[model samples]
Target chain A: MSKPLILVTNDDGITAPGIRKLISIVNEIGDVIVVAPNSPQSGKGHAITINSTLSFEELNLDGPQRDFSCSGTPVDCVKMALDKILPRKPDLVVSGINHGANSSINVIYSGTMSAAVEAGVEGLQAIGFSLSDLKWDADFDQAEEFIKEIILKTLENPMPKGIVLNVNIPKLPKEDIKGIKVCKQANAKWEESFDERTNPHGTKYYWLTGYFNNMDESEDADETALANGYISIVPVKFDLTAYEYMNELNSVYQ
Target chain B: MSKPLILVTNDDGITAPGIRKLISIVNEIGDVIVVAPNSPQSGKGHAITINSTLSFEELNLDGPQRDFSCSGTPVDCVKMALDKILPRKPDLVVSGINHGANSSINVIYSGTMSAAVEAGVEGLQAIGFSLSDLKWDADFDQAEEFIKEIILKTLENPMPKGIVLNVNIPKLPKEDIKGIKVCKQANAKWEESFDERTNPHGTKYYWLTGYFNNMDESEDADETALANGYISIVPVKFDLTAYEYMNELNSVYQ
Candidate 1:
């Protein structure tokens, strides 16, 4: 049988240590190709380049996988990768091994998960991985085995249509890990906090800063799972429709 | 009591005619404040600026409302407005009078809807308004009464928490329009089409272009309502969790 084809990407730019680890892991499983943003696009959720043109250059990176960096958002990289670079439709699209957490409400602000969601939007199977640690030299070694296991399992048993997996590893060693937990997105958000500062030019500028507020600590919540030292996997979807509220909304308009 | 504080914003920049019309319509209804992007930020779905600084300048626009043009994405405008400009947490947040349609699947890629969704995330009553016509001089006069009715109704009869309204008007005259229909988002997507070209330096550059493909023609869908000459309203939620597939996904992981 032919090997599975995997496309790897990240929001931390092409040369980040995180993507390099992701490439190494997926290389053993499939014919891997890396198409990612040329710069860090951490909070660029589902953004695409509409008013601008896009360009990309091939790279001679150290890996069996082919890598190219595109001058656009993470979603744009996925769009451009599918249109220009790939020889055929990839069997699976995997993103990240990201440097920080995308466990709950962070998914909306995360470029890593947005790339995965964009792939899901295209009707392809995709997954996004993130570690709870933000340090560049953060230990990715612990996530290796479980990452391989999850990829192999996904390849073996495909998910339903319009669903992708968001996997966030706890910031603990492999031995300290309490195994994987499939959970729901926790009700969480960043409290809107902007740090106001003044520049030397006499004009005032502000920096967007926020404190992470985990509003749900329920057993099934991804935040709870992560806090309990388990890798949390939440089945993610791109459809933003609130199905439960439709009938009531219909009545209101009627 | 002071009138309802209605915050108005858009992805088409603060100076666009659509917003000017929106500001005029809402001026009679409430004490309004406008905080929108300095430039057009269409298709900037839910993006925020974490790695940079932001600046805004207040302007004395024609209405009772104060207007500020901020150097950030649509989502950024909402955050900044809440954190700095507004006198208090707003009574309502209204986005757009967008120059194009945001019915059905278009909501995922829309900065107009993103701004509304951002407001919804902050637990505010929010609504996004869009018109089917993309013309600079498209007629918005037809939507005045209904927009007021919806806003007034929304204030009097609050929608359930965490749900925002996505209202799209068809390109029809006031009389010919078939009033309003509350509906669900149609399953639709942009058929991936990239226009590849070479720059003067012989380097390849691409334009992100596509045809809108309406996959679902269900009578209750937003697209269907719009196509049949009625304004469509779909309740949008920011939570992208696939709740229906959770149990099955858990079993697969187990």
Candidate 2:
């Protein structure tokens, strides 16, 4: 029997340890195809390269899966894969196992989740996985069992239209880690600060910096669940319409 | 009496006529401050510049408002403006008088709308206005009155938190226009295609192109309203969590 076709990609460049671990894990369950950015695209959001031309090259990444690294954003990789590279429509599209977190409000600025959401927009069942750690050599070995379970369950039960799961793993050791929890997005924000610097040519420039502030403490929020030592799965959707305010907004036009 | 602080921005660069008109329109009602990209940033989506240094220069645009041109994406401009440029938290953030359509699924790839969404994330009232015409010389005269009305109404009646308006004006003569309609985002998508080309060096490159495919013909859809010659206003939100599917998804983990 043919295996389920899985498309694996990440926001961390193609050679990142995170995607390497993800590819190996998924290879055990499906026929994997790897199409990811050639360079890091950390906070690209749902960006697509419209003005520039794109080029890609084949890679020999010690895997059975056909791999190609493309010069584009994470969302662009998804589009290119669907249109040019994939053998057919993938059964599941999984992104990330990112080097950093993509939970709470971070999802809006996340290239990993944006790739997953782009797949959702194309009517594909997708998931984005991330760890709380920012290290390139972070411990992904601990997430093997739970990640496999979630992927298997998702394959068995397709995600509903317009929805995808954003799964974030706590940075705990294997045995000490608790279970998984389905939760809502936490109300968190980045308290941004700019580090000002002066160039040798007498010009001032700034580097963006910020710290994540998780404001929600509700038991069902992703932040709370992760704080309690469980992996948090938040169902994310692409429809940005605020349906509740539609009626009131209409009244304004009246 | 102090004027309301109105922050103006666009994805089409600070010199685009669309935003110049927007600046003029808002100047009548508020003290305007324009902080936009130094070059055209069309289709940049919600991207932010993380790995690069950002630079901005005060501009001498012919208006009562202060102007600054920044070397960043639309979302970056918003962040930079709020963090360093603006005198205070703007009473309202107005993005675009975008020179093309940002209706239906186009909203996802829109830098113009992303600026407003970023403002919404920062807990500010924001609106993104776009015209269906893509011409640099498109007529903005007809939109003057209606745009002012919407802005004034929005200022008088503050929008709820996390919500921003995406207003798309049809490219019709003002006389033939049928006012405005508050509508939901149409269930539409892009039928993406990549045009392949090979350089003399024999390496293949792809240029992204696509056409909008609107599958929803429902009465209250933004696409439907635009087709009927009416200005379409969709109240968009940044929170991506799908609430209804959370229960069923939780059952899977159980």
Candidate 3:
């Protein structure tokens, strides 16, 4: 049987340690191709380059893998890979061994998940991996075995159509780590407070800063699962339709 | 009581005719403050500027409406407006009288809808308006009365918490247009086929082009309403959680 083809990408530039680890792990399972943004595209949720031109350069990085760096957001990288770089449709698309968590509301602001979402939008099986630690050198060692297990499982039994997996690993050692739990996104948000500062020219500008606040008590939520030391896996879809409210709102409009 | 403070913004840039018309209509409803992108930010879905420095300049062209043009995405404009510009928390936020349709699957790629979603994240009542026509010279006169009615009603009775409206107006004249219908997002998607072309340098590039394909047979979808010449008002929220699937998937993980 032919090996499963895995397409990998990330938002934290092509040289980030996260994607390197991701590429190494996936290489053990299948043929891997890494296409990612040339620079950090944090918080670049689903944005695509429309007004400007796009360029992709093939790279000969120190790895036994195919790689390309694109001058665009994560969504653009996925599109470029699928349209320009890949020889054929990949069996699975995986984004991120990200520097930080994409649990709860963070998934909406995530470039990592956006790539995964874009892949799912193109009718491919996709998954986004995020660790709960932000430090660049945070231990991804613990996530290796589970990552392989999940990838193997996904390749064996494909995900449902239009659904992508958002898998977040809790910051724990392999021995200390609990099993994965399927969960929903917590009703959480960031309280944005811009730090007003003056530029060198004495002109006032602002830096967007925020503290994440998760107040949902729902134990079945991704936030809750992460807080309890389990790796949370949420089945996410790109459609934002509030189907239940349609009938109630339609009556009001009529 | 002082009228509810309403923060107005759009993805079409502060000087776009569509937003100017929106500001004019919103000026009568509340103390309106406009803060939008300095240039067109189409397709910047939920993106926020993190690595770049942002600046803003007061514009004199908001036409009797106080306006600031920010060098950022639609989400950044909303954050800056809330944290730096507005004196206090706004009771409501309205984004766009956008020049093109943000209906069905387009909402995921829309900078217009992202502004409104940002407001909902901040716990403010919000709505995004888009007309079917893409012309810069498109007549917005027909939408005046219904827009006013929707805004007035929204201010009087805010949306259910965490819900924001994605409203798309049909392109018909005022007399020919049917009234609004609250609908769910249609199960529609963009089928991308890149338009490959050669530059003057003989290097080939591609323009991201696609047609909208609606797969849902449901009559109560946004695309169905818009196709039938009725304005569609879809109550959308940022929570992309597939809640129903969580329980069923949990069984697998365990």
Candidate 4:
């Protein structure tokens, strides 16, 4: 049988160490195509460039995979790849090894996870991987074996339609890792404290700053798993409808 | 008793007719404060600006409500409002009367809905309203009474935490419109067809374009309700965890 076709992309741009590591691992598993944003798209969520045009250029990155640098957000890259670049529907789509954790509430603001979610919306099996460390030079190699194992396992057992995987690794050594845990998204949020500052012109401006507030102490929560040094995998769905509340809402509308 | 404090915002920017209509209606219901983006932020999803500084300027729009135009995405507008703008926690948060439909899968790509989701994440009662018409000058005045009714009802019945309402009005005249129906998000997606062209610099560029493809024909779907001329109210939740598949996922991981 021919190799499985894999589409690889990330929000940290095509050249980020994280995606580079991700691409390297996937290359061993499938025929890889890298369509990633040309610049960092952290926190871009599911943004598409609707008001403007987009472009892409082929790059000679150090890999067997074909690389295309896209001039849009991470979600845009996935759309562009499926529409204008890929020769066939990929067997699997993988996003990130994101520079920071998208463990809980961060998933909604994550370009990394959004790309994966967009693919899932298109009925493709997809996964987004992130590390808890936020540094550009974070040690991605530490969890290389585990990442490969997770990808292989997922490719064998494709996720259900409209569902995708959000995998986050703790910032620990490979030996210190306590394996994987399937968990629910922790009920958490960022308490924003915008840093008010003045520009050189003496005009006031604010920088977005926040602290993660995790309120879920449940053992099955992703944050709890990560805190316990386990790699957390949360099955995320794009069907945002709250089915349980439909009857209650119907009564209210009446 | 003190009047309810309502925070108003939208993705169509501060000066759009849709938001103007929203502000007018919200002003009648409570003490209103509008903090929306300075320019249009269509299809921005749940994006938040983290790489740059943001600023807001007070505007003298023709209303008893106060207006502030922020230089950020819709989600940023909500975070800025709660963190630095509002004097106290708002009693309710309403977003849009968006110039286009945020029904079905469009809710995932909507700036208007993202703002409402952001408020929901903050544990506030929130709702996002949109009109089926995409025209800039869509007759938002037609559904004024219905909009007010929905807002009042929602204020009276606060949604459970992590849940918000996505309300979409059909394009028919107010009298022709059927009553509202609470429904689930339809199984739908956008079939992307990128329009490629040659730029002035002789480089190839592409425009993102897509057609909505609704596969769901269920009577209980939001898209179906809209097609039947009924206003659709879908209860949207942000906790993406697919709980039903947790056991299945756990087995695979093990």
Which ranges of candidate 3 are over 4 A from the true structure?
B198-204
Q: Please state the error at residue B171 of candidate 4 in Å.
A: 0.4
User: Residue by residue across A53-83, what tens digits does model 4's lDDT show?
Assistant: 9999999978799999999999999999999
By TM-score, how accurate is candidate 3? Answer: 0.96
- Itemize residue pairs with steric clashes in candidate 2: none
lDDT (Cα, tens digit) per residue for candidate 2, span B1-254: 68899999999999999999999999999999999999999988888899899999998868799999999999999999998899799999999899999998788889999999999999999999999999999998888888999999999999999899999999999998899999999999998899999999999999999888899999999999999999999999988889999989989999
Estimate, for each residue in A148-234, the C-alpha lDDT of model 2 and write its tens digit.
999999999998889999999999998877899999999888877878899999999999988878878999999999888999999
User: TM-score of chain A for each candidate?
Assistant: 0.99, 0.98, 0.98, 0.99
DockQ of each: 0.82, 0.87, 0.72, 0.92
Tens-digit lDDT track for model 3 on A21-120? Answer: 9999998888899999999998999898877777777899877789988888999888888888888999999999999999988887899999999998
Q: Arrange candidates, best lDDT first.
A: 4, 2, 1, 3
Residue A179's lDDT in candidate 2: 96
In the range A23-127, model 1's lDDT, one tens digit per residue, is 999999999999999999998988889999998999998878999999999999999999899999999999998999998888988899999998888889999
The CA lDDT at A18 in model 2 is 93
lDDT of 3 by residue, B1-254 (tens): 99778899999898888998998998887888899999999999989988777888887763556888999999999999987889999988999999999998788889999999989988889999999998888999999998998888777666777789999999999998888888888888877666677889887676777687889868888899988988889999888877767666766666
Between prediction 1 and prediction 2, the one with superior lDDT is 2
Residues forming the 10-long window of minimal summed lDDT in candidate 4 chain A: A154-163
Clashing pairs in 1: none
TM-score comparison, 2 vs 4, better candidate: 4
TM agreement with the true structure for every prediction: 0.98, 0.99, 0.96, 0.99
Q: Give the TM-score of candidate 4.
A: 0.99
